[model samples]
Target: MAQIGIYGLGTMGSALALNMAEHGFDVAVTNRESDWIAPFISEAGDLAARLHPYTTLAEFIAALTPPRVILFMIPSGAPMDAMIDEITPLLAPGDTVIDGGNADFHDTRRRTAQLAERDLHFVGMGVSGGESGARHGPSMMLGGSAHSWQQLKPVLTAIAARYEGAPCVAHLGPDGAGHFVKTVHNGIEYVDMQVIAEIYSLLRNGAALAPTEIGALFADWDRGPLKSYLVEITARLLSYTDPETGHPMVDVIKDAAGQKGTGRWTVIEALRMGQSASMIEAAVGARGWSSEKATRQRAETILGGAVGAFDGTPEVLAEAFLAARILAYAQGFRILASASEEYEWSLDPATIARIWRAGCIIRSALLDDIAAAFDQHLPQGQLILAPQIAQTLARCIPSLRQVVCSAMHGGHPVPALSAGLSWYDSMRLGHGSANIIQAQRDMFGHHGFERLGRSGRHHGPWWD
Candidate 1:
């Protein structure tokens, strides 16, 4: 019998099955569409020997060894629910079901509890890295019980990407922690991409740099502290010329951006937890604005467009980009910390950093330093407060300020970068301008304000 069963023969599912089979694990595979099973196995070549294809759910369940571990790679909402309902009766008492999709954490939590009533195990696993990563190695965040972890550790570790010889997979916490972290990871990714795009705009429009020049610049940055998967890919993308028109590939592509909702989910959850994710919010907003391409074009025609040039050096732009990137990561970590407290997940920020250090789109050299900072146990779990990060921020903040000012004056939008700077400024201020707003509120709405020396609510003099 196969050791594990993979339900759903989608891109991720097929790749994971092949990955598992190549690692010498016998895998039972099935799909809603029965026709896909034969073609998948046939394409597996020598790996097909270890793969057992089942056309029916009953046969698929029967093919797996008892106390089974079945991973679902389907859509997360009603489809996932339907699959669970169909498989629950077939599963034994100790069987485990893993949801390996970009699921909402709240749904994961609900499913975890629902399955427990039947004495079965449910794991919400966040699988990262794209198709290539899944076929080779991927970073996995598993949220489940100790029992489920024990059952799947060997296979998961075998297929996971390694950083310094350690697998980038972990049993993060119970229920929803894994998916939640992945959501925040995507949120940070949105901001990271946005900031990079803003820098590209500055270079292209303000500095009048060619695509190849910007590509070379990004390639150079990849060898420095800004080195990352996204940067590396972006460098390659910018350098590519379209075969049809012989123009830069990026120049020919439309400006509209598309999203899968994970970034929006992160911002929503952060706000629900009473934490600020302003950079992520800005990134999400920028994407929304980009979608209204016609509206933007009309607005530009009516109000005019950017005419000023950026006079800053590339070194200063790099530093500014680095500063914004750091602040954006700080915001993401703070949200994770807040969610951990609210959900009692006890998530290890160090572990998260370590896992993200490799096999993920956002993987970078900086994560090593972030992991070190968390190892020192940051005060109040604030990543920005860590001495190393704070030192870096100190060096970069001035450059960030210069970039934001120059970009704004040039009539170029740097929403993510500007938001990061604004958040940093707000965070550092010991006193803020909220008192006047509080006085206004008290005068108009009879809302009370607290006096500086007193704990209890006090009326403002504006009421008199």
Candidate 2:
């Protein structure tokens, strides 16, 4: 096996290093401190001996073999910049450096251009599956020069989680495209999880199902077409019993949600590009509003009922929720597919389907459907719209659309969910009120608008 250097030992880097070690690669792992090194060595003994600890960036770079391959697994924004800046000066020609962190795709593009001057190859890679997935195998997204990708091929393929018949990692276009895909990958995850949470809450509170009962229901979905990580989480979440009195665990927590950044970025970017990412954006807004309980109190005091009782069993309701959840993801993912086209991202929809099939948080059996959708439309570079998916959407869109509308009527906050649902309607129907969108855009910036109602000119500037 070839030698590889990992420059940071955070959860992701450490797991990658361990995976490499297990596979008999001469993996040199380093952190900024000596203390963190011993524990890793202790836990992974034989693999430990292959580990190389370095207190400084310079030393880590110096230890690499000729035609060096060093992967930086550090924090995203600042740490990535500082490490790359420091090491780029010391690197020789043909030496490749891969940033296996969630750095911004635009940043990757700039960094790639900068590294070219020194003849030091730079690759921006997106690694998902969290820590546990990394240790076993991860879903990796590679973006950079095709030449650099070829050099890292076998090792990357060997390390990534395999699905159906494909590697989780793929050469995703040029420059920042890999990171862009990963960024949107996370955006899709946000929509997926939000829809699952909505379904679980509806089942638990609205349908009044007990915790374990729900678990059994989700377990069934695990064996069906709806099977996936999201469903598995539903099972796990429903399994937890309270520690205080050994009762059901969910009643202990408050109903508040928090987010870091990617969801917000995805929605903003999608809107800026004029793509319909309403479901994903609505999800982001719904989470933001959940933190404001006072608003919920007002809605309860003034407005009407939102989600109501389900007379169905866990099995029946589970299928309904899964079908609804499918519509939500399909809506959000469709926006992503469209945005990729508008921005010239050139994302390989098949690889994305493959990656999501195994290592990522949203891995679902639906990936098979996604794969077929991509294969069917590969020559056209079309968004996901296959016959089976259309049937699934047809089965659930009306219910989801009503669910979103009713929530809004009751003054409940639900941006992504509602938007995602609407996104499906807009794409499938194509008779959406573009006039409303154009009117709003013109109202804000006086941007020249196009009108189908009447050709050549200004359709706005009406007094409210």
lDDT of 1 by residue, 1-464 (tens): 99999998899999999999999999999999999999999999999999999999999999998889999999999999999898898888999999999999999999999999999999999999988788899999999999999999999999998999999999999999999999999999999999999999999999999999999999999999999999999899999999999999999999999999999999999999999999999999999999999998999899997569987789999999889988988999999999999999999989999999888888988999999999996876789899999999999999999999998998889999999999999998889999999988888899899899879998876667
TM-score of each: 0.98, 0.87
Where model 2 places Cα greater than 4 Å from the true spot, the runs are 293-345, 378-384, 398-417, 436-464
List per-prediction Cα lDDT, in the order shown: 0.93, 0.73
Model 1 clashing residue pairs (backbone): none
- For residue 257, give model 1's deviation from the true position in Å: 0.4
Model 2 is weakest, by summed lDDT over 10 consecutive residues, at 377-386
Compare the candidates by lDDT and give the number of the best one: 1
lDDT by residue for model 2 over 325-443, one digit each (tens)? 56555545555567567657677676677777888777888878777777775433434366676677667555566655545554444455566555555665657677788888788
- Error at 39, model 2, angstroms: 2.0
How many steric overlaps are in each model, in order?
Answer: 0, 8
Poorly placed runs, candidate 1 (over 4 Å): none
Residue 212 in model 1: lDDT? 93
